[model samples]
Target chain A: MKLQVAIDRVDIPRAVEIIRQVAGTADVIEVGTSLTKEFGVRALGPLIEAADGTAVLGDIKTCDEGKYEFDLGFDCGFAYLTVMGSSSLGTLEVCYASAETHDGVMMIDLLECDEDRIEKISGFENAVYCLHTSIDSGATADPVGQVRAFKAKYPQIRRIAIAGGIKKDQLAGLAAEGVEITIMGSAITKADDIAAACAECKGLCG
Target chain B: MKLQVAIDRVDIPRAVEIIRQVAGTADVIEVGTSLTKEFGVRALGPLIEAADGTAVLGDIKTCDEGKYEFDLGFDCGFAYLTVMGSSSLGTLEVCYASAETHDGVMMIDLLECDEDRIEKISGFENAVYCLHTSIDSGATADPVGQVRAFKAKYPQIRRIAIAGGIKKDQLAGLAAEGVEITIMGSAITKADDIAAACAECKGLCG
Candidate 1:
């Protein structure tokens, strides 16, 4: 299990500061969707640089024109890029192909996708299928339970990541449930001692 | 009927030049999702200025954290912003409220939503319900007929917009079908003479 700290709603300098603080402590540092939209993927070179060798994921949340968006994100030095699971299958296929070609990772964000939709998009072997809860809908009540249910429903999906208001207390359960990545946003990034918070969360995930 | 010209896959200077050419002729000039992702919404001030008096819409395509994205887009001086219909109902509600508060319009992108999902999200009275076809899925074969079917099914949705590879020949039929907005991309933007193509399409719409 790996801890992915998502940095959102902050300017590039501040995002860079946070990345530098938590780079080695967190397994992956995510450039959140808000930062991507506010600053643009091309402008994220500083954040990418701040991460040093730690893997960086850009939560671009692509819905259409997948190849273009994926190519742009990877070109900007993102280790992983996200695409919406709600996007058309063709879009998903193109995004996956782009990821494969770029030798980067693709994380499919299943924000509002239903079971039938997920089942149809479950064939990507290397892609990480994320069970994401919308921020507007609030935090996931039982993330471990959610992962368990998701695993039971779609056992074929090997790479699983869970996100949306995840706290440190739930990291162990998520790891025990075989969650490949446990993404925490404000819980770790906005803490009083950001580095210590990330280290604690990473320790818990182990 | 309104002719909304979408400018996509071009750099900022090129986007500004295109806006200058077609601003007054097209009713709305869309800063397409590609531009928003590539250049960032905050950096679109030049494009907004180039539109002059014509409405400029930022295709932000908000899926989650609606208020934040909407506020950012609206604050950047976009007359309209888009939200995905596939978003959670809660996300949609916040986006609508943000648009209302900003005195801007919200265009709901119905890309991959089924009828049930559309019905569930159809209550936003002021929103322009866009019957969008994914670029990856190829062009819409019968846009006017698609609009007719959508209207027949969801009569409660008043402000209807259709997009995706719309050509000059389809504008009259879309207008006759009582479509509120007909969006064209490369057909007009990528044409040899963009201004003339826009003027001709505007003439066809009338």
Candidate 2:
């Protein structure tokens, strides 16, 4: 299991400070969708550099213009970029090809995606299918159960991730249920001692 | 019929200049999703200001963080903000409530959204349902047929907007089909004379 810390809705400079602070403690440092949209890809250098050899993931959440967004994202130094599972099959296909070209990674955000849609986009060999619960919809109460349900439906999806208001308490269960990466935002970033909070969560994932 | 001019993938200053140039001539001036993400809502302040008395639409394409993004967009002086139909229903609700509270408008970007999903979100009375074709999937060849089919399937939806490679020649047909708004981004913005092109398109809509 990996601990991915998502830093969101903050000023880029402030995010950079947080990124440096969390350096090696996080296996995956996510430049949240808010940051990408707010600053564009040009501002990702600091975050990528601050990762200190750890993987960098940009939550681009691209629904269209996949190749342009993906190419720009990869050029900006993300090991992984995301495409919406609900995007046109064309968008998902191009995103996959772009990621493969860069030898980077692609994570499909399954926010509000139905089973039929998921089935259509299920065959990306290197893509990680994320069981994302929307923040507005509130956190997933039983993430383990959600993952189980998702696995039962799309067992061909080899890599799986869970996100949205993930707490430290659910880490063990998520790991137990074979979730590859658990993404948490405010729970860790907004904590009193960010590094210590991240470390504790990383410890649990380990 | 309305003419929506979408400004995308351009720098903030240039977008502002173009918006200033197109102000009252365009029924709606769209700050494309790329701009919103690239420049953030703060950068949009002047562009919204440039709209003068004309309606400014921010294609924020809120895939998540509906309330925050919509509130930010509204506060930035946009008359309308967009939320993706592919987004979670809760995201749609949050955006709708925010738009209502601000006395603004919500445009649901139906990019890759299926009939079942559209059926579920067809209840927002004040929302404009857009029949979007993905840039990744290329343009819809038969805009008239697409609109006719969509209207027949979702007749309860009162207002309709169509986007994706809408060329100058199709404007008359789209208008005759009772399309509420015909969005032309590249066709107009990329024209030899943007304002002249916009005027021609608006002529057809009127």
> What DockQ score does model 2 reach against the true complex?
0.64
DockQ of every candidate structure: 0.91, 0.64
Residue A66 lDDT in candidate 1: 97
Model 2 chain B lDDT-worst window of ten: B35-44
lDDT string for model 1 (B36-97, tens) is 99879989999999999899999988999999999989999999999999999999999999
How do the residues B136-189 of candidate 2 rate in per-residue lDDT, one tens digit apiece?
A: 988889999999998899889998999999888888888888898889897877
lDDT of 2 by residue, A1-206 (tens): 99899999998788888887787988899999878766666666888887888898998889888888888889878999998998988999899999999999999999988788889999998899998889888888888889988888888999999998787888998998889999988988998999899999999995
Report the Cα lDDT for residue B41, model 1: 92
Leading candidate by TM-score: 1
Off by over 4 Å in 1: none
Which docking class does model 2 fall in?
medium
Please count the clashing residue pairs in each candidate, in the order shown.
Answer: 0, 1
List the candidates' TM-scores in order: 0.99, 0.95
TM-score of chain B of 2: 0.96
